[model samples]
Every structure is written in structure tokens, then in C-alpha cells.
Target: MIQLDQVTVRFRIPHERIPTFQEYAIRWLQRRGVRYSNFNALNNLSFSVDQGETVGVIGPNGAGKSTLLKVIAQVIRPTQGRVRLRGRVAPLLELGAGFDYEMTGRENVFLNGAVLGFSRRDMARRLDRIVDFSGIGDFIDAPVRTYSSGMVARLGFAVATDVQPEVLIIDEVLAVGDAHFQQKSAARIRKFRQSGSTILVVSHNPASIKALCNRVLWLERGVIRLVGPVEQVMQQYAPDAPSPFSK
Candidate 1:
């Protein structure tokens, strides 16, 4: 269960890059204020996801899809309006987002569990399962920085989904790793869906969205373009594209 009312997340970016802190300090001392431009990552967004509902978010790059997910995930606070969530959330927003590169994969797993509010003992119980699902094998004891990108994604996805959270927020994570792992991740997602967990997924893959979500929310330029049944929105969103959602 989640709700966002008139949520707006605005960011001020410097007009020009100051390569170093020294340059910035010099500019500051000179009383030459840095110029900034405001960009709205999410503009006046209002939406709700009911418990046990699976919603897919579709949009082009820079269309605020990731921003919307981060807002719901509470990783970024909105500059305006309100966000309300009612459940324990497990977010797989970015590949290896919560990992400590210097730590062993085994160590990072416990760290991530703690971040999600689980104790080390709790993680220990789930350790073997997480490692086995990731298929990282012996590499699980190596530093995370030594892992390949695919390895990192596999471990992260395995840890996040194994929690069986009340709310799951995914952002293009299913596209990572190999096809076998992708299928495994999809199966895990389906299990959560059947267990009545609320899920919000952002993906460019129309087929995955259709297979996993009952509704689709299309966003454009930081605003809602359409929010309705998967087929209804998919038809207008990608009418020329070939997919099962097409008539």
C-alpha cells in the first residue's frame, strides 16, 4: 500500500561544473554566486498502489521513472506534497546499491540485511539460500569489488527478494544478469505476487510488464501520461511496437 499526493521533487544543478572544491571556494569568496537551474525529477505526481496490486511503470529515459520509484522507496524526499507507505519495503533500485565494495560478498549480505532491519543472526539463517540463489558459489567470500557486474546484480536481487517484503520496489533490475537468472528473478517475483505483496516495477520491457503487472502507469516528462489496464496503456504507449500487449 502506497500513496503519493501532489509530490514534486525538484533539484538544483549547478550551471557549470567546478572541477574542484578549491574552484568552488574561490568562486564563493569572490562573491560570484554559482548559477543553478531547477529541474523537476517528479512534478506534481499523484498516485496510489493498493495492497497486493502489481503496478508497472513505463517511460523513456529522463521521463522520471526512476525518480518516481525512489520517491516511493523514500530514498529521495519530495520537495512538495506527501508520500505515505504502509508496509516493510524492500527496494532493489540500483545494482549493488547498498553494497560495500571493500567487504566480502558474505559480509555485505549481513550488512544489507541489517539495513533492511534484520539482525546478523537473521541474515545467517538466510545466507546459504541467498548465496545459492545468486549462484555466486565460492566467489561469495570474495570482496564485492572483485565481482563482475552480473555477479553483483545476482547477489543483490537474491538478497532483496528473499525477504518476502510487504512492498517490493524494483527498477530495471530484472534486465541485468543472464537469462537464467532473469527467469529465476521473475519466478521469485511471481511468488511474491501470489503471496499478496504490493509490487511497483519500472521496466522498459513490455513483455515483462504485461506478464507481471495488472496495471500500467505511463509517465512522460515527469508527469503522468496514462494509468490504466496494462493493455489499454500499452496500446497507446507502444502502438507500433510488436508485443503480446498489442492487439
Candidate 2:
């Protein structure tokens, strides 16, 4: 199971800067301080998820849904609180930031696999399958700079999930892929759950949440507004518009 207890993220910024260290030290001695806004991204937020469960997270753009997912994925540390992740975690946070643009996609496969905690031999064993699943075979030997945003997302997701993490934390990167790959990715997620991996999905798309998640967590302004069955959460938070199929 995964547990987050009283997780809070605080950030600080300087209201002014001095060109020289001496000037900054003089200002500090004079009690001149910078103004700042403290934004508590996850305010004492806590949750738990059992294995094989799919938990969908929803909220406004800055409501900290992505922040909660990152806390679980260990991509970002909480300023105050604890996150207990019980297994191997794979996080799909950024589409192309993890890949080296100067390197071929094939090299990225190995590089990302290692970054994801896979051994060299393990990455080698999964490279072909990852390439095949990405559906970017023609460009696998090309530098990622040559691939479109969608293609990079596809390839990155494929590599991120190749090792079959015990806990999958998905952010909003799905927005970059095509519908076909979206469905394919959904199938892959189902397969992962079938193998007993827990999934925590963060997306605003209600259909995507309903299609893959069994439970849901809705956050607003860093607090969990709702947490329950997926259908119930959808009923509570669904936008007035429609899913892609509604058109």
C-alpha cells in the first residue's frame, strides 16, 4: 500500500536581489527582507491505496493533483510530512525531459531504463519490446530532437513502463499522445493492474479516469475534496461538457 501523511510543499522566493554579495550582506544587516507568498501545495493531505487499485486524481489545474502524484512518485519531496511508497514506482511526469535530445531514441531507452532502476541486462531484454510498443520504430535510431511531441511522449511512456513498476504514477503527459496511443496505453495500464500493480492517475478527463480507475481522489487547493468510488467522484466533479465520444 501507499500512504501519504500530512504532506506539505512550501516554496520561497526573493523579492529583491543585489548584484554583489557585499551589497546583499549589507541589506541583510539592515534587516531588509524579501516578501514572499507561501503556497502549501499539499496541506496535510493523506491517503492510502492497496495493491492492484486504480486511483484517479482530479482537480483544477493548480489544485495539487499533480503534486500529490509527484509525492508518491518521489519526483518532488514534501516540505512537511511523510510519504510511504511500498514498492517500485514508475512516474510519467514529463514527456521528453527525461530523454537526451542529442542521443538516439534507442540510447534513450537504455538510459531511461537505467534511470528507472533497471539493470543494463534488464534494459537490454526490454529494449525491443519497449521500441515495439512505442510504435516509433522508424525513429528509434534517430535523435529525440527529430521526434514530434506526441512521438516523444509515446516513446517516453513506453520506456517508463517497460520494467513493470509495482506502483504506477501517471501525471498529465497523456495529453500529448494521439487517441490510438491513448487507448493502447489504457490497455497497457489494465495489463499492469492485472499483474497486481497499483496505479495512481492524475487527469482532468473524466472519461480517462472512469476508463481505467476503480477509485478516485479529488483535490481542491491542496486539500482532498472527495475520495471514494470512481463513479461517485465523477458524478460529483464531472464538467458540464462531454467526453470525447459525446461528439
Candidate 3:
């Protein structure tokens, strides 16, 4: 289960004229002509995902969909309000996010597992399955830096979903990789849903959202535009929702 109450995430961005850090610091220290603007990536957002519920987040660019996921994923802390989560979260927020490019794919697997709070033996037991699911073949033993973006995506998804997490947070990284791999990953997500895992997914692919989510949250410019049944919200969000190919 997950809950967010009056959550807000803000970022202070400096003006383009203050290009260098030194210049920005000087102006700040002088307390004269300091130029910066606050951008709220998430504005007083509140929502709850019940146990075994699958929620889809859809929005246009800069709509704060990813920010919502990151907040739930605990990658981004809210500047106001509170978030409570009562489950182990496996977050596939960004491909290769916790990876060490210089490390071998095999090494990164263990590293990621450790980051996910798995013991050495636990990772060892799951290693083979993760590798097989990723379908990275001989590349698994090579440095991650040598991998293509698709390869990284495959590995990241495999490792993140290997464990039976209580909550799964998936960002748009699933949109990467080949079609075959995407289907494989989607199938795995379906399995998770069937097994009653709570899932929060952010995707531009309308069809994927429709297939995986019973409820959809539509966000626009850091605000919640709508939240309800998938079809209802999607219809209001994009009446003639573009086809998957357009995504």
C-alpha cells in the first residue's frame, strides 16, 4: 500500500544569464539581483494505491507523471506533506540508474540486488533467472558500458522484477528495448498483477496502460487532472488517444 498526502516537490532553477556556479554564488552572497525561479514538479498531490491495485499514470511531457512515480519510489522527497509506504518497492524508474558503467553486467546485477536489500545468497539464487529473462547472452559478462540502451533496459527490468516485491514502480523505461523484449516484460507485469502485487506504472503507451491498469491518474502541469477508471480517465485525457506506434 502507498499513500501521499498534500505532497509537493519544488526545484529552484537559476537564470540562464547566471551560467557559472561561481557567478550564481557571488550574486547570492551579495544578496542583490539574484535571479531564480521555483518550479513545482508535483503540486500538493494526494493519492493512495491500495494493496493489489494496479494504477497507471498518464500525462503529456512536463506533466509531473514521472515526478509522481519518483516521489512514490522515494527517489524524490517531497518538499511538503507526507508519504507512507507499507511494502518493499522495486523501482524501475530509470534504466541503469543504480548501475556502475565500469562494472560488468554480472557485477551490476549483484550490486543492484544489494541495493534492493537482497543478501548475497539471495542474489546468487536469482542471478541465473535474471540473466535468462534479460536475454543479454554473452554480454552479461561484459562491462555495462559496452551495452546498448536496449540491453541496459532489458537487464534493469529483469533484475527489478526478479524478486516478488510488494510494490512495483515502473517508469517509461519499459518503452525502450526491442519489441520482443517489451512483450516479454509486459507479460511479466501481467503476471505480477495476477499475483496481487501493487503496481504503479507511468507510460506514454495508451494501450499498455489500458491493458495493465484498472485505474488511471491523469496529471497536467503538476496537478491532478483526473483519476478514475482507466477508460474514463484516458478518454478525458486524450479523447482520440494516439495509437501505440505514436508513443
Candidate 4:
């Protein structure tokens, strides 16, 4: 099981995250004006994903869905609150965040695995399987930059899932592959569920969640407005269901 307690994540707008923005500071400079120079990506957000269940996070743009995923994945620590995981979490966030651009995909396999808490021996045993699953061919022997975006994504994904994690976190990056590959990935996720792994998915495509998830949570302006069945949350987030942006 995965749990979050009053999590909060804040990002400074003109900070190291996205390079200093002098113009943004200038724009905010106004007479008798008060503003938030920083942004709160997530605020007191809390939820749980029980093992053997699929939880989908849905929301409009800037609604903190992605931030919540990152927090659960431990890709970025929360500024407040805490997340407790039952076991190692395999986070399939970005295509290359877990890889090394200077190293061959083959070399990166072990590196990424270690970063994910696997031992060298374990990765060695899984190397061939990961390579085969990636379907990247000889390019695995060359630097990752030389590989196509889709290739890197596949390789990274294969490495992340090297061991069946107790918790699995995925974003919409899986949409990069061919239909067959997509199906394969989906099958892999299903297998995880069959084995009793907890799953958390964030996607703009709600149908995937409808097909795979048992539970869903909706976020609006950094707070969870709803959490329940997938079908109901999808209807709540539906475009025609009254835009969350409207007055």
C-alpha cells in the first residue's frame, strides 16, 4: 500500500527549477500589488493507493495531478507531509530522467537499476530481458542520445520495471509507442496487478484509466475535489461536465 499525509509541494517560479526569469519579476513589480512570486504545485494533497488496486489521478490543467504522481513516485520529495510505501516503487515518469545520456543504453540499464535500488547481480540477470523488451537493437551499445525518443522510453521503462515493484507509478509517457507496444505495456501493468502490486496512473487519456483502474481521484486547483469510482470521476472531469475553469 502507498499512503500520503497532507502533502504539499511548492516550486519557486524564478528559481533554479526553470532558470531565473527577470521579466517575470518585472511583470510582478506593481504599485500596491501583492502576488505569489512562487507557485504551489500541490497543497495539502493526501490520498492512498491500496495494494492490488489501480488508482487514477484526473484533473484539468495545472490541477496538481502530475505533482501528486511525482510525490508518490519519490521522483521529487514533498515540501511538506510524508509518503510511505510498502515496497520499492517503480516510477515511470519521464522518458530519460532515470537514464544517462553519456552512457550506452546497455550500461544505463545497470545504472538505472541501481538507482531504483536493485543490486548489480539482479540487474545483470535482468539485462538480457530488459534489452529484448526495449527492442532497441544495436543502438543499446551506443550513447542514449543516439537512440530515438521511443527507444529511450522503452529501455527506461524496461529497466524501471526490472523487478516487480510493490507500487507502480506511471504517467502518460506510454503514449509514445506503437499500438502493439502499447498493448504490451498495458499487459505488463495488468500482470503487476495480478501479482498484487499497487498501481497509480496519471493520464490525460481517461479511457485507459476506465479500462484499468478500480478507483479514481480528481484534483482542482491543487486540492482533491473527489475520490471514488473511475466512471464517476471520469464523468466529473469530462470536458462537457462543466469546465473546472468556468465561473
Quote the lDDT for 224 in model 2.
90
Query: In model 1, where do residues sit more than 4 Å from their true spots?
Result: 19-32, 242-247
Could you give candidate 2's per-residue lDDT for residues 77-120 as a string of tens digits?
A: 99999999778988877754468989999999888877777788
Query: Can you give the TM-score per candidate against the true fold?
Result: 0.88, 0.89, 0.89, 0.82
TM-score attained by model 4: 0.82
Ranking by lDDT: 1, 3, 2, 4
Q: Give the TM-score of candidate 1.
A: 0.88
Model 1: ten consecutive residues of lowest lDDT: 238-247
- Kindly list the per-residue Cα lDDT of model 3 for residues 1-247, writing each as its tens digit: 9999999999889766746778767877889665679999999989999999999999889999888888888888999989999879988887666899999999999998888778989989999999999999999999999999889888988888897788998887666589899889888888888898999989888887888898999899999989999999988777786666685
Per-residue lDDT for 1-247 in model 4, tens only? 9888998999866433342456456556643223336677888877877779989888889999888888887779999999888987788887556688889988999888888888999989989999888788888899988887778888888888757898888888657567777787778888998999998888877667788889988888899899999887787677454445788
The best candidate by lDDT is: 1
| Cα lDDT, all candidates | 0.89, 0.83, 0.87, 0.81
| Candidate 4 wrong stretches, greater than 4 Å | 13-38, 239-247
The 10 consecutive residues of candidate 2 with the worst lDDT sum are: 11-20
lDDT of 3 at 126: 91
In candidate 1, what are the lDDT values of residues 1-247, reduced to their tens digit? 8999999999998888854788888888999978889999889999999999999999999999998988888888999999999989998886566799999999999988777778889899999999999999999999999999899989988888887999999887777689999888888888999999999999988888888899999999899999999999998888757766677
